[model samples]
Every structure is written in C-alpha cells, then in structure tokens.
Target chain A: MTSILETENSDNQTQKEITLIENILKKTGPSYTKYILGIGSVLTACLTIWLGLFITPKDEHLGNTVRLLYVHPPVAWAALYLAFGTTTLASLLWLWPKTRSYFWDKIAGASAEIGVLYLALTLVTGSIWGRTTWGVWWTWDARLTLTAVLLVLYIAYLAIRQLDGSDKTKANRNAITALFAAIDVPIVHFSVLWWNTLHQTASVLTPGLHLTVPLSMGLTMGLGFLCTTLIWGWMMKVRYDIELLKVVDSEIELQRAIMQRRNEP
Target chain B: MTTNERLLKRRKLRIVIVLAILLVIFGALIYEGLTNSIEYFETASQAVANRQTLGTSDFRIEGNVIGSTIKRKNEETLFSISSGKTVVPVISNGSPPQLFQPGIPVVLVGHFAKGNGPGGTSLLFLSSQIMVKHTNQYIAAHPNRVKIVKN
Candidate 1:
C-alpha cells in the first residue's frame, strides 16, 4: 500500500512540473520577439553580403570598388533615419508632456548614440571610396561639408544631455537641440544638387542606383534596415528600464533623507 | 508664473523660433537641388566619343596610359589614354604619379575642351586631379612599393 501511494505521489508531482513549465513558456512567449528580430537580421546581413560582393556588376570605371556603395549608402540612410526619429519623438514628448516624456527622452538618447555610429561609418567608408574614385580622401564639397556639420550638431546633442540639470529640464533642452539639428539632413542630402560640388548626386535609392541593381540587393538592404531598427529598439528598451530604476532609487533616497531630518528635529 | 518659470518659457520659445528658421533653409536647399543637378561617370573612350554631348559638363573618366606616349614639358604632362578602341589625349598641369606607368589605370576629373587647330577640331584636355588604380594583388605583391616610390 505504501509503495503504491509513493508512485501516485511521484506521478502527481511530475504532472504539476509539466504544467508549471507550460505556464512559464506562455508568459515569456511575447518577450522572445528579439529572437525573431535576430533571425531576420542574420538573414538580411547574409543577403547584403552576397548581393554586394557577388551580384552587382563591376563598374566600368570604379571596377570592384563600386561594391562599397552598398555599405556606405545604407549607413548614411540609417543615420538620417535616426536623426529624424529622435527629433520627431523628442518633439512629441515636449508637446505632450503628460504622455511618458521620460520615455521619449531615453529614446532620443539611444537614437543619437546609434546615429553617431552610423555617421562615423558613413564618413569613413565614403572617404575610402572617394580616395579610390575621386583621387582625394577628403573634400570641402557642399554635401561633405554639410554632413560634417550635422555630425557635430548631433554630438553636441549628446554632450548637452550629459551636462548638469534636472531630468525634465535636460530632456526638454536636448529635444529642442535635436529638432534644430535634424534640419541638416535635407540640406546635406541636397547640397550636391544645389552646388557645383565634387560629391555625386543622391542616388534614387541609397548611393543612387548604377543601372538597376539586382532585386536581391534591394531585398538584402531592406533586411538590413529592419534588423538595425529592431536591434536598436531592443537596446533602447533595456536602457530605459535601467534609467527608470535609477530614478526610483533616487526618489526613495530623497524621501528617506526627509524622514531622518524630521526625526532629528 | 514665477520669475524663473517665465524665463525658462522664454528660452524654449527662442529655440522653437530658431528651429523654424532652420526648416525654411533646409526646404530651400531641397528645391535648389531638384532644379539643377547632373551626374555622370564614364571611361576615357566614352568621354572622347561623346565630347560634344558632354560639353562643359562635369564627369569622371577612367583609362590606362599608352606606354610610349607620356611627355613632360616643365609643369605640364602629356599622355594618350586608351580604353578599348578609343584613345584620348590627356593634358595635365599637375604632377604625375611616379608609378604612373603605361597600362596602369587612372581616373581624371574635368571637362573636355574643344579647340580649332590643324586637325580642324581637336580635343583639349584639362584634369584637376589624377588617381592611380592598383589591384589588390599588385598592392600585396609589393607592400613597401608605395613607400619607396614618391610622387
């Protein structure tokens, strides 16, 4: 009788364990969104590499150096997207402070950081490609000049955030600066067309299309954009959580200080 | 409102005004670029063939120098570049690369000039800058070649 009871208890425990596991999986299912993002990113990165290195025809003039266009143009586009996104979000936050103003501030900070990375990559890749084709690594051409200004403005946006002020005030100030800096995007984009400059005109797509690139190339680039946005969004979410925790801790400390002072009196 | 609060509001208003001005400037630039802009890339042969079509238009041209035709008279260097069957005379006022030998690829940036001469009409060459194209294999073969060769 004892043995039969023990076996029944063991079976009951196993069934309970299985149910618990199923519940845990259900709860975490939505949070696994990053995995889907990761898969998409990997697929796009592979496609980009394949199309850029293999599918595109060698230029009659630039030869194999034309491949750099795929990488450089996308980076520049991503930077523009970052700047625009940050400015729009910041503006919305300021205009409607009742709705999660701190959240938008964190997003603006994240976008600016990502924009800096892409902007730097664009400059480096563009210079290298220019050196190969244009004979000069750097030129004071209108497009290049304006882009440099844009980079400086965004860098200043981050610097301003780091300087002393209350979180609310700092967010407002940085948002204003970001909105102003975003003006440089269209200016930089159009400078080549407006001025007699050495920099090439903007391509229909990124870096302008040299004839019609293979459909696979476009697909690959689309993938890259999607992946980058997903990864960036995930990172931003993580950072925002940390910031909120810090804010809560500070508030707790402030309240504790007030209570101690009252007790002493 | 308190004095400090009023001052902050004024500062924010100033920022809004500045941003509006910047937006106007950016809009103007876009309009300008859309109305006036031309981009071209060509080989030396194509540039020679379509000289009249590309008159005064800024373009990039690439070709290899004909081995026995490079000449120097003071600051000016003269050479014939061949891309397939097309040959073009390149007249550059700038210093030529030391490794700029025959059969090596070079890109020139400038416009073709039309001149009336003994040949009825001749193409006058003008290049502001020159770039030498070296293959990865060529560069890898002689890692210290660029260091030793001065242009």
Candidate 2:
C-alpha cells in the first residue's frame, strides 16, 4: 500500500512540474534597459526625419519624394541583412556540434523578434516608394514578391519558436527552422539582377559601380543608416535581456518545486 | 550502448538529416534561379530581332525616349524609343507618368503593333505601361522651372 501511494505522489509531482514549466513564460514587464532602448529609438527616429526633410537635397528628377531614399534603403538593409544575418549566424552556431550553446538559441530568438519589425517597415517604405515612383502601390514583380515571401518566412520562424515543447526540443527545432528560412535572403538580394522587374537595379555594388549621390543626399542617407543601426542594437539588447530573465524564472520555478517535494515529509 | 549514448547518436543523426535536406533545397533554389529566372527586358533592337515571338506575346522592350516624337493626342501619349541603331515607335493609351520626359531611358510593356506597311513589318508598339529607369540623381530636365500640370 505504501509503494502504491509513493508511486501516485511521484506521478502527480511530475505532472505539476510539467505544468509549471509551461506556465513560466507568462507576460513580463519592462526593465530600465527597455526604457533606455525605447527613448533612444524615438530620438534616433526624430533625428532621421530631420535629416531627411531639412538637410537632404531634392533629387534632380524625383523631386521631394526622393527623401524616401534615406528611410527605405536603410530599413531594408537592417532587416534583410543585419538582423536576419545575426539570427542566421546564431542558429548556425547553435547547430554546430563543436560550438553548440544555449545562449545562441536565445540570441537567435531575440534577433528574429526584432527582425520582424524591420521587415514590416521594409515593405511599407518600399510600397510608398513604389507608389510614388513606379505608379503602382504593389505588383507581383520578382523583387517585391520575393521580399514579401521573406517577410512571411521569418514570421513563420518566430511562430515555430513559440510552439509548446521541452526546452531542449524547442531549441533543436527552432535552430533548424531558422537555418532553413535563411535560404530566402540570397534570393531577395539577387532578384533585381536575375529578373526583369519594375524595380530598378541596385545603385550600389562593387567592381566599377559608383554611387553618385550629392553631398546633402549622401549625408542624410549616411545619418539614416547610422541611426537605424544604433536603434537596432538597442532593441536587440533589450530583447535578449528579457529572454535571459525568462530562463532565470524557469530555473527558479524548478528549484522551488524540488524544494517543496523534499519538504513533503 | 547505454541509453544516453544511443540518444546522443540519434540527435546527431537528426541534425545531419535536417542539414542534408536544407542543402538540397537551397541547391534547387539556386539552380532554379539560374535556369528559369525572368530576364531583364531586352533592348528594342534586341527584341526587334525576334519580332515574330516578341510581337505575339507580351514582352518588355527598353530604349531612350525620342524627344521630337512625343505627341499627346487628347488622353493618349504617343512616343518613340531609340537605342541608337533601332527606334521603336510606341503608342501608350494611358496617360504618361509625371516624370516621363524625352532622352530618359524607358521600358515599355505591351504588345507589338501589327502593320501592313513596308515589307509586312510592324511599325508601332501598343504599350500598356511606361516606366523610366535612370541614374540615382534625379537631374530634372528643366530644374529651374515649375510647371504645375493640372489634370
């Protein structure tokens, strides 16, 4: 009778542990770091707007709408190249047998969360530019289409990471999912050159291609790039910090459950 | 082998299988992009060479707008595009875009106009859309002037 009673208690304890583990990832509040990032992001955004409007020169052809040049390219660069690249590298590091680290999984998740925001901005700014320049708001053209696909793919990555699983299972699954979705980056980059599309070919590239931006325009674009990059870093740090907190929370909960079981004399 | 050893081996095998699949998928994507990717439209002269195929199916042809040839008849904007060697006459039913101008490189998307004049040749392109591609700097043809076109 005592053996049966002990077995039932053991089973109930295991069930409770699983439930607590699942519930540990509840909503979290902002910290001082999040506040700093939020303030810095807003300031940078304001500076970018000032640079674009007051300082930049009207394009020789596109006129004032040319100001979009600052926002569109920089946002797209951050999303598609910088944020996405970081996520890919983190996933790769986690997957590598020699370099596997739980920290990489958290980095991948945080960068990807930030990447979704930048990706949405990329589409919005690109659409605005297209509406003004291409005479159409959206088209099924290759470059635009491929970029839209990339946005959807990364959103899927975030969704997969949210699926309920054990910590190890989730980590393994998220790493593989991230590595798979990164395949679209090359396609988005080369879409302009590969396909005849309404979108113009890239103005900047190596091997004889030169950017002929006037001083004012160049300065604004440069400012926009720097500001967006700083903002991106700030956001990433905040996100990674929150992820670390969640991990700590989970560990504390597990420790508490163990102690409770020991005290149950 | 111990259960822990077997589990580790299985995890490694899963990683290898997943990576192999990803490699194959990416290889296919690159191959597809190379073989069947859309071509940036050919020059008007280039397309003119394959008029039989190009004229029937909707294709894109590009050239510089010829200034003297621009004619705005009521709602229609008619113009000719040139690439030094061959000039393709284009008639666009839709109104020209705001930045549309002479000497600018433009790509016309539409069908070839069938003609009975001169050795059964086609004279004009029936354009559904006109797009301009140029250098990064927008050098307004007449930068100093402000012509508020009311339509």
Candidate that would win on lDDT: 2
Could you give candidate 1's per-residue lDDT for residues A177-207 as a string of tens digits? 8788787888787776666465665544444
Q: Which sections of candidate 2 miss by over 4 Å?
A: A1-40, A205-209, A250-265, B1-37, B116-121, B138-151
In candidate 2, what are the lDDT values of residues B32-89, reduced to their tens digit? Answer: 4444345547788877777765545676788889988999888788889998689988
- Please give the TM-score that candidate 2 achieves against the real structure: 0.75
Model 2 C-alpha lDDT versus the unseen true structure: 0.75
Q: Compared with the true structure, what per-residue lDDT tens digits does model 2 show for residues A82-126?
A: 889999999999889898998899989888888889889989988
Q: For model 1, report DockQ.
A: 0.06
TM-score of each: 0.58, 0.75
Give the true-structure RMSD of model 2. Answer: 8.0
Docking class of 2: incorrect
